[model samples]
Target: MLNVDGLKNGIVIDHIQAGMGIKIFNYLELDKVNGSVALIMKVSSKKMEKKDIIKIENVVDINFDMLGLMDPNITVNIIEDDKIKEKIKLSLPKKVENLIKCKNPRCITSIEKYIPHKFYLVDEEKSEYRCEYCDEAYKLEF
Candidate 1:
């Protein structure tokens, strides 16, 4: 069995979908962090059957909105003094900027390099987002 030590003061990103942990790890730039970080993948879970977990040995800033978009099922646990200080459940963000690109060729965002790519959640069930400027639809696939 694989064993990973618990954190004393850091964050635990739990319930990451199998195979998605590496993406999240890379996105968070865990490789560059000075603190100890552990990426455990393909752990058996009763709730999910399989999941990934990331443990950090020092507190770090995270963008929860981006995480929600990537995987709404993820949960964040803050650890302090070897105990869980707080638990944060993630959900799809109502609005996001610059994370998703507008694909419409004629959209202003496409023409203007300075324009930020903006999208609004149109369908939570479908994981659908629409470009704020062009109304172009983008469906997230995970």
Candidate 2:
């Protein structure tokens, strides 16, 4: 019977895998936000058995690509006037830049300081990505 108030205008990040709420919270820099933010972890869910939820009291700019990369199962709900205005389903991003670094020692990215690390989805089922320059593979583990 834990009760949390509905947001009048804000964003609700739902369906975060259990134990990931803190990571998402930190990634979003919620601690530095001036508005109210509630991070509820380990909530019961029939779909996931356990999940985390983050409620922000004011709308904030979010990088959806980074969010998707962190957890593709997450859903973003935009609230306005205490009602859901939009529901966004996240999936693995097809392309990402500067999010994941090319770990290959001989990669050009390692030699060039000005280059932005870039990766492209190579295998969706395996959550695998390849470095755009070096073809080094990186896999995301949920």
Candidate 3:
């Protein structure tokens, strides 16, 4: 049995899809930051069959919108004194900039280096976000 200690004060990113924990870890720059972060992968889950988990032993506000865009099913648990103080259910943001790059090569953002890669929520039910510059559609692949 793999045993990991509970966080004293930090955030727990739960309900992550299997194989996505590393993406979230890199996205948050956990490696560069000096803090205790545990990335548990391939855990059995009743709902997902298999899932990943990330426990950060430090209070830091990460980009929730990016999490939502990547995996809207993710749950954020804010811990304090080894207990959950708040539970945050992630939702896709209306607009996300620089988090996701526009893949369209002909898009202005792709041509111009200075412009930020911006996407807008086009279809909430489908979890579709379109590039603001070229209207390129992007959907989260589960």
Candidate 4:
């Protein structure tokens, strides 16, 4: 019976994969923001059976590309005056720069710290991304 007050004007990130809410919270640096942020983890869901939710009490620019990489199934709900203004469904980004590192030791990005880690969406249905440099493949569960 956990009850959280609704946001007056902000954004709600819903349908986060279980156990990933903390990662998203840190990635968004919500703790550094001077606003109320509510993170509810492992909540029961009809679609997912278990999921995580984040409620931000103020409008903030969110990196949709990072969100897409982390979890494409996530849904973003824009709220204003305690009502949902819009619903945005996240999808895998065509390219990600500096967000995810190439694990291949031989990759130039691995040696060159200045080079931004770049990955391209190679498989949408499987949520697979490949490093632009070494052709290293990364698969993420959606």
Error of 1 at 28 (Å): 1.0
Task: List the candidate 3 regions with Cα displacement exceeding 4 Å.
Answer: none
lDDT of each: 0.95, 0.96, 0.91, 0.93
- Better model by lDDT: candidate 1 vs candidate 3: 1
Expressed as tens digits, the lDDT of each residue in 1-142 for candidate 3 is: 9999999999999999899999999989988767899999999999999999999987887988889988888999999998999999998899999988888989998788999999999898988889998899998676
Whose TM-score is higher: candidate 2's or candidate 3's?
2
In candidate 2, which residue pairs get closer than 3 Å at backbone N, Cα or C atoms, i.e. clash? none
User: What's the distance in Å from true for residue 105, model 2?
Assistant: 1.1
Off by over 4 Å in 1: none
Q: How well is each residue in 31-139 modelled by candidate 1, as lDDT tens digits?
A: 9998999999999999999999999888999999999999999999999999999999999999999999998999999999999999999999999999999999999
12-72: candidate 2 lDDT, tens digit per residue: 9999999999999999999988799999999999999999999999899999999999999
Q: Candidate 3: what lDDT? A: 0.91
- In the predicted model 4, the residue pairs found to clash are none
How much is 75 displaced in model 3, in angstroms? Answer: 0.6
- After TM-score superposition, the amount by which residue 108's alpha carbon in candidate 4 deviates from its true location, in angstroms, is 3.2
